[model samples]
Target chain A: MIDEKGILFILSGPSGVGKGTVRKALFEQDTNLKYSISMTTRTKREGGEQEGVDYFYRSHEQFEQMIHEKKMLEYAKYVGNYYGTPRQYVDEMIEKGHDVFLEIEVQGALQVKENFPQGVFIFLIPPSLEELKNRIVERGTETEDLIINRLKEARNEIEMMDKYDYVVVNDNIEDAVRKVQSIVQSEHCKRSRVAKQYKALLEVDDK
Target chain B: MIDEKGILFILSGPSGVGKGTVRKALFEQDTNLKYSISMTTRTKREGGEQEGVDYFYRSHEQFEQMIHEKKMLEYAKYVGNYYGTPRQYVDEMIEKGHDVFLEIEVQGALQVKENFPQGVFIFLIPPSLEELKNRIVERGTETEDLIINRLKEARNEIEMMDKYDYVVVNDNIEDAVRKVQSIVQSEHCKRSRVAKQYKALLEVDDK
Candidate 1:
């Protein structure tokens, strides 16, 4: 992939589908990918959620300032908290031929698609709708009303997956990670991406 | 891939680019793929090339008859010998959801493209054109004119790679095989191929 612009890989899915777990597993193995840390105005979780590693902690005022300055590639408000991907860092890394990995919610992912239309969008799904419901139910703390609402939201998000380029059935972490890695590998070999390079290299006029 | 029709994977490149070696290496590790052994009118090579294993050797008259009967998927005459893929066997295997792998010449690969346009066409390339010429020259058996002619033929084939879906630089056998395997893995995840199944499975009206 040297001298070629690195591809942007966006992994997104509905809530409670283990996107975070799968993303963690994928990164544990693929050192070649640069994780694009997201900026958030929400409070970071207590357990080892360091700034820049888990999320770039920011004040609401600063988050709005970034939006006003056209700094964010995509942003969404969840529970009155600002969450967005920084544009400059991703653009700089990919320009240096380093593939950038982004794990986000469905809304932010769709927004990112508007800016980086050529980016590879992967939708992670539970094995079945029944499996998704079971996972939500097993969490055990949610009231019946909350559980029903989450399922309804999930159904809506599933419909939006038509916009994605690949779907990884998160039956397990290893398989999901492997499929994602294969997608990255295959995208690098895509004819549309590499054809010009090969043509330029081998189309000698020595005939 | 169960219940889904198998994909045809075509591995092709200019002569002396080592398509055969990479195909062998790929099959040795990935048994999920079924190699579509080609048929030929040429006499089997001396070193243990078995009938139906290496190739289904046929007489010139029989090969022509099969062609006349439209039994061949794609065929080309090489060095006065007719070589072609058996259409019936490949179709049966793919219908049963077994991926068929075909390693073939550039001309014949293009012919197969016309027939199975959905097939994944991967064009293997040498590290450099000079490297391709070096490989041919290192054989040290062909006349200088023959080597020049082969290089010219290779140049033309490389140009035809625009018709392919993927281009793998065969710098070494291992890397080439890995790239091909990745393509198969990723193709199985393509939205055009799997979206309907996912939509049906997840689209519930229980809201």
Candidate 2:
């Protein structure tokens, strides 16, 4: 076995960028990928998602303790709920050679960038603002005012593209997924990351 | 149409490392890629390859004048023949939105790196030194002494892998080709290159 360390991919985009759909498609294509389940302080409703699968449900006091202990990779308070990625599972998955994908908001993503600078940060976007607005309307799940809010939020998020390492335009879901997958594969071959592998190979004697 | 600027990929490896086969396979897969045609001062043999397609034949004086004018991206003298990549065609191709793949030796690749610092430099290598020597001997195209010399040259080249941006191990030709192609695709999506596109998208006014 190569025992290669798995890459941590931080994926973030605005609300109407179709990031969730693209991420689902990518996971379907690559079995070696593991999605990072976040930790949240929200209440678990009846017949709601599973605890470890969807998220690690935590009490407000516990979440605060985690923050104080510096266990969260990135955290943010949204709508009075504390949401963040815990570092333990991510560390375990990477050690076992499973690439971990963390989907987060821009603020939380930047927080992760500060904590783990080695992670590859990718920002997904629509081809244009007009297309983004159209996608939001086509979803048929939000009110007109909410749609406008999302569009404004997306505009602001797009300005942070320079902070990320790669940008994937979500013009087509399949194409975007393929581009993200390629980025993961190629990042593994970067010289800075694979210098140890090269050294091991070169150290072998030749007769 | 997206007027995307082309990327220059500089590939360097020792002789008999299967760079030619990998490059041929990659070109067959991506029609948008352009194989760089080198300029050589050697005399064209009868029933040989076509001009401008295989190599740009030049007189010694013309080649020296090119050296004087600093027109070569990289050049080296071997067996009294001056072989190099001319800058004019590469510049034109890249300007026309064609990604140029320059396959050269290690020294020439370092020269191109000096000349075109923006190009992505990749060092191709065998999986192991034993495999490298085995492949050299298996080729059956050189004498015993030449094979030994080539193996030594390959060992020296492997030490230079640190100077590259990426490294591709040619354990399997198909896999190596896919890795290189993925590197090319992923590099275009890098934030350093796509930030301008994001800026253009964000500049579109929304009401």
Give candidate 2's TM-score: 0.96
Per-residue lDDT tens digits for candidate 1, residues B1-112, read: 2247789999999999999899989989999999998899989899899998989999999999999998888998889999899888789998998899999899899999
Give all TM-scores, in the order shown.
0.91, 0.96
For each candidate, give the TM-score of chain B.
0.88, 0.94
- Per-residue lDDT tens digits for candidate 2, residues B115-155, read 99999998898887778778888887889999888888887
Off by over 4 Å in 1: A42-51, A57-62, A204-207, B42-51, B57-71, B203-207
- In order, what DockQ does each candidate have? 0.58, 0.76
Cα lDDT for residue A63, candidate 1: 95
In model 1, residue pairs whose N, Cα or C atoms come closer than 3 Å (at least 3 residues apart or on different chains), thus clashing, are none
lDDT digits (tens) for residues A41-90 of candidate 1: 99989788999888899999999999999899799888999888988889
Highest TM-score among the candidates is held by which one? 2
